[model samples]
Target: MKLKILLFAALCFLSATVIAQTKDSLKTELPQISLSPVPVEVFAGNNGVSFQLIVSKYFKPDSRLGFFNVTQFTGKYDTADQAKNELMSLALISFDIWKGFSLNTGAFIDNYGGFSPTAGIQYLFANKDFLIIALPRFDLARNYNFEAFGLAEYRPMFTKNWGFYIRGQAMYNRNIKQDFLERSYVNLRTGVTYQNFQFGLGYNYDVYGGTFNSNQHSFGVFLRAELF
Candidate 1:
C-alpha cells in the first residue's frame, strides 16, 4: 500500500509541477520516473515510431557500457491532448569506467524525460572509504529548454552505507521567450542509507532571476536505484 501511495504521490508531484507551469513554460516539467526509463521516445505526431539498437561491452577494469535505440509505432493514447499515431525514435548510451576512481557518461536523442548525455567523475579516498560524484548534467528537447547543471552526491562513509551528501544545482536556458523564463535553483540533500539509496528531503530556493513565479521551501524524497 505504501508503495502504491508513493507511486501515486510521485505522479502527482510530476503533474503538479507541470500544471504549475504557464502554457509556455510547461516544457520543463517531468515525472519522477524510474531512474531508468528505457531510452525511448513517445510522441504525438503523424509519423509512426521506430526502433534502434544500442550495444554495450566491458572495457577497463570493472568498467562497462551499453546503448539502447528504440522506436514507437502509431498508437492510441489515454489523453485527448496527446498526439495520435505518431512515430518517434530515441537512442541512449550509458558508460561507466571504474577502478579506484569511476567515471560515467550517457547521451540520448529526442529528450523526453531529461535523458541526455552528461559526464561525471567519482573519487574515492582512504581505501575507497570516502566517495564523491561530481556531475554537471543537462536535458534536451522542448521539455527542458532550461538546462540543469550541478555537482551532486558525496558519501562520507565510502565503505558503509551511511553518510551525508551535499548537492548544488542550477537551471537556466536563455532562449525561452518569457518574462520569468530564465531561472535557477539551489538546494541541499543530506541523509543516510543502507545501500545506494538515500533517504531524506531537499529544500531549494528557485527563481527566474526575479521574484514572481519563484519557488521556495521545495522539498521531496531522494532516492537512487542503481544497477551495479
Candidate 2:
C-alpha cells in the first residue's frame, strides 16, 4: 500500500513539472545576480576554462571579512567567443561572530565575483586548518520584493588556496506577479573556488506569470582586497 502511494505521488510530481515547463516573465524578470561565496573551481567555462584569484584576512581568530574578484572568463571554448571574456561577478564577504558563528555575503555582479551578507550570528565548524567551513545565514536586504533566503552551505578545500562547495539558497517575495511574471525566484547553486575567487553554475525553475522554464549555467570569478 505504501509503495502504491509513493508511486502515485511521484506521478503527480512529474505532471506538475510538465505543467510548469513554460516561459514565466516573473521568474526571469529580476536580475539573476547576488553576492554569495562559492569556490573558484566551479566557475569553470563550458569546457575546462576559467581564470580567477582568491584572498581572505582574519580580523581576529574568530572574525574576518574578505572579497572575491575576477576580470573575465575568456577562452577559445567560451560562449563569449573572446580570449578575455569575463563579464560576470559574485563579490566575496567574510565575518565571524560569537561562538564559532560567522556571516558571508556578496553581490552578484560579474564573473569571478561574489559577495555574502554581514548580519546575523553563526554556529560554525571547520573541516581542516581553515581550508573548509560550514554555516547557515539569515539575511535581510530591507526590500519587500527582495527578501533573502536562509542558506546552508558546505565549502571544502582541494589545495592550500583552492576549494569548492555546494549551497542551497532560497528567498520569498510577495511581489511575485502571477499574471505573466513570477516575482520570486529560488536557486540551487554549486561551484568551486580557488583563493578569494570562484566560479558558479546554477539552475532556476519557478512560476509567477505564464511559466517560462529555463536553466542558469554561469561562470564567475572575483578578487578580495581589504582596505580598513
Candidate 3:
C-alpha cells in the first residue's frame, strides 16, 4: 500500500511538470508586436511653410500574414483657404508573397479621391543605410484612377551620432477612364541628421489640373523628426 501511494504521488508530480513546461513553450512561441514611431516633416519653402504628419503601424500575428495602416496629412500655410492641403490614408491586409514583396488588399481614402476600394502591391526594402517603399494601386471608384507612389531615403553616417540624410518622394495619379493626369508631384530633401532629427534644404515641384498646365515650384529649408 505504501509503495502504491508513493508511485501515485510521483506520477502526479510528473504530470504537473509536463503541463507547466508545455504552457511555457506555448507562451514563448506566441508572436510579439511592437508599435512604430510617428514621423513629422515640415518644409518652409519660398511659397509657404508646409507641415506633414505621417503615422504607420503594422501588426503581424504570425510570419505569413500581417496588417498595415498608414495615414498622412499635408497642409500648406500659404493660403487661407487651405487649397493645397491633402490627406491620404490606407488600411491593408498584407500577405507575404515573396522576399520583399507583399500582396495587399485594402481601402484608400483621400480628399480628392474620396473613399476607394484599393488593390495594390507593396514592395519594401530597408537596411541600415537605406529605406525604400513603392506602391502602385488602382482606385475602384467613379472616374477610376491608377496611382503610383514611392519614397526612398538614404542615410550615411558621418559619426556615431550624426549622418547625411537624403530623401525623395513622388506620386502620380491618372484617371483611367477619362485619360487625364489628375495630379503629380516630386519632392526632394537633403540635410544633416542628428539621431532621429533632420534639418536641410528641400525642393518641390507640383503639377495640377487635368490638362496639367498649372505648375508650382518651391525651394527652402526643412525640419523633420520622429515622435515616439
Better candidate number, 1 or 3, judged by lDDT: 3
- Give each model's whole-structure lDDT: 0.36, 0.38, 0.72
- Model 2 residue 196 CA deviation in Å: 15
Best-fitting candidate, measured by lDDT? 3
Candidate 1 on 50-155: residue-level lDDT in tens?
2212122233332234343334333433466244323333343433233222233445333223344433332222222332223322323333332333334455
TM-score of each: 0.36, 0.32, 0.75
lDDT of 3 by residue, 93-164 (tens): 865444455556788887875888866677777667887878776765656677788889898989988999
| Candidate numbers, best TM-score first, in rank order | 3, 1, 2
lDDT of 1: 0.36
RMSD (Cα, Å) of candidate 2? 16.1
Q: In angstroms, give how far residue 160 of model 3 lies from its true place.
A: 1.7
Q: Report the C-alpha lDDT of model 2 over 30-66, residue by residue, as the tens digit.
A: 2111233333332333433444332334433322343
Q: Which pairs of residues clash in candidate 3, taking residues 3 or more apart in a chain or in different chains?
A: none
Per-residue lDDT value at 182 in model 2: 24
| Candidate 3 or 1, higher TM-score | 3
| Model 3, global lDDT | 0.72
